[model samples]
Target: MKRTLVVGVDGSPESRAAADWAAREAVRRDLPLRVVHAWLWQPLAYPLAQNRDAEARLAEDILKETEGDLSHRYPGLTLTAEVLAELPVPALLRAAEDAEMLALGTRGHGALAGFLLGSYGQQVIAAAKCPVVSVRSAHGRPVALPEQGEVVVGQQGGVADSSEVLRFAFEAAAAADAPLRAVRAWNSPPVYGYSLGPMWSADQFGGLEPYEKAALEQALEPWRLKYPEVEVVEHVEQGGGGHVLLTAASDARLLVVGRRVRESSVGVRVGSVAHAVLHHSVCPVAVVPHP
Candidate 1:
């Protein structure tokens, strides 16, 4: 069976926006969409607890409401809804195992707000097997993916670390018929520490922007060949990665970034760039895990 696109909803405005975004993505990918809600049972004695059946009914109601809205919006789109009797993190991760991608609602405030505010969202994104898209609403409504604005993706390191990010960005741009903006940021080398013989050429003493731009183009050449139809705009700037990506994606419909999958006894790491963009990006952000 084909993997479906899964989206988690808790009836918040941000979640509703995610559902809207996911539905459109499903249409674009020609994939089935699954709308899910995790319903963890709490004891009746708990302060905010209701009866078990009432809680279950409420969970089902949330799914029903979202399903109804999305079904009405996309008449021909294949959609399904379910309520999982488990906690949010594991439940969504399990659902994502068989999914093409997972979409979640995120707030556009400080680093500690929305689904991403705590460990819940972080856990799901770090541990999931597929790409996770975090979406935010604008002015109390879902921001529609722009047709003209480019689909921006941050490229770092090399093709090995950023292949998945580039692939997702190219496919998204192709699907939306929009341009793809590939951004690479760099910082100048320290003035005193280095031998200039091997690292710097005679002409490079003046500046390194040309070399940085060339490296960026080299990293993107293969992708450009593969996606010949995608109009790619290469952007190389001198600054921090997160700041440069956010600025380049200011008018973007979607921002794609790579998260290196790391296993640690302490916890999963979302990386500095991904973390920064997740906290502040104005458009929807997709975190693609890569080696």
Candidate 2:
């Protein structure tokens, strides 16, 4: 099947907001949009077929309504809706395999009290093959990023194979005609004091600041050249990765981060930094899967 921007939707306002966000992104990328709703029917003691029919109808209604609204708002946008009789996470993951990106909605930032990520949304973010954007629902409406805001990207501060994430961030900024804020963090190793070497004074460690700044600049140089129109802002600071990114993304239209795809003995492994931003960012968070 042709690639499209896929959105996972339910009847909730959060999911509706996700669908709306997907529509806008699809328009930006000039791609088709697909809305997917997954449903399951619990077995009843009698008339199991009736229960299944009711569940299917409800799922269909959700898809149809979302499709209609999006099509009306965005005329001539290629659209398709599907109702999958499978588990939410697995179905969304399957849909994501062929999608340019998968977007879903959440209640709010997890750092706030009484805010928790739905199990299915968390599972899809951890395992989806493509980039996944998580948006929050508030005021019973779709949360839209400010049109004039910049796109913030978190990096590891050196020139490495973080090209996929960087490219996505740059392209997004270029598309929106907004600045790209590249944020990198630096910190002393956790074992600094316990190391064999003698303790170093603050003055002795002050020289590292320039090195970190140079690394961030070098890492962003080529991308800057490639997208000359995009204004680049580099922020190199000494702090925890997650906190640095969270603060940088506070005024961003979208926060982009990389996720290295790895198969561990336990299961899929997501970096702590990406996991934290996914849960806490106020704006939409895009987790780009990298090899």
Candidate 3:
């Protein structure tokens, strides 16, 4: 149960990109990197012995290739590779339980089409105990963290709900020596044609901006003090949370968002804003689970 940074690889271009990103992050965090590939044995149509052996060999090859590439790039990094003989979703979930963070590559269809995450990726992100980062490869290769770009994080709710997200964002920014942009979005109260009582004033809607701005600043105060080296940019906007965060992260090196752990009869759920950012953000997206 050693804590390490884990990256899942599937021999796809996107997974290669994720492995590269995870290696860099591991170096930054001073943690070992574990490369994992899950191979689900499918019954062959003819049930040939060679087919099964070939499949197993391919899985090992994928791990070795990824390990060699990453080791070449990060010679000082401690790394290991393993192939799990299980379904991907459960294998990844188990791998993430003891990991500091888990990184997975998301397939990007096109610039405007956004990322396409399979059901397994969604399930893993929803249930992982540690933060899950969805990385998209740019130009069929790994996208480097921008030197001047900030680490943008969507901040909402109170300190209790947002503290984990902020902590991750600040630590990422501090590691990269980049600025941290904290964004909060608010919607004006809906106007009612008829006022029920004098307690309801039309001026209340216009005055919400200041209150929201103050709340965002207050929530960020402790984090700012804790990571004094991280330059913070506070953004308060009136719009949809997802859209606001996406716009702020247009030039970000990393975008951090929070997913509240909610239990349902069916399964765990990722919040709407986090879902949207995961699909559309151009930068690497980190979904941190919080209470």
Deviation from native of the Cα of residue 191 in model 1, angstroms? 4.5
Candidate with maximal TM-score: 1
Local distance difference test scores for all models: 0.83, 0.80, 0.84
| Residue 264 local lDDT, model 1 | 76
- Tens-digit lDDT track for model 3 on 43-143? 85785564667778878898999999999989999999999877778899998998999999886232212222456788888999999999976666656
My TM-score estimates for the predictions, one after another, are 0.89, 0.85, 0.88
Go through the candidates in order and give the clash count of each. Answer: 0, 0, 0
Query: What are the runs in model 1 whose C-alpha is more than 4 Å off?
Result: 44-49, 108-118, 137-147, 191-207
Lowest-sum lDDT 10-residue window in model 2: 108-117
Model 1 is weakest, by summed lDDT over 10 consecutive residues, at: 108-117
Superposed model 3: Cα runs more than 4 Å off: 44-50, 108-117, 137-147, 192-206
Cα lDDT of candidate 3 equals 0.84
RMSD of every candidate to native, in Å, equals 3.6, 4.9, 4.5
Candidate 2 local distance difference test against the native: 0.80
For candidate 3, the 10 contiguous residues with the lowest summed lDDT are 108-117
Winner on lDDT between 2 and 3 is 3
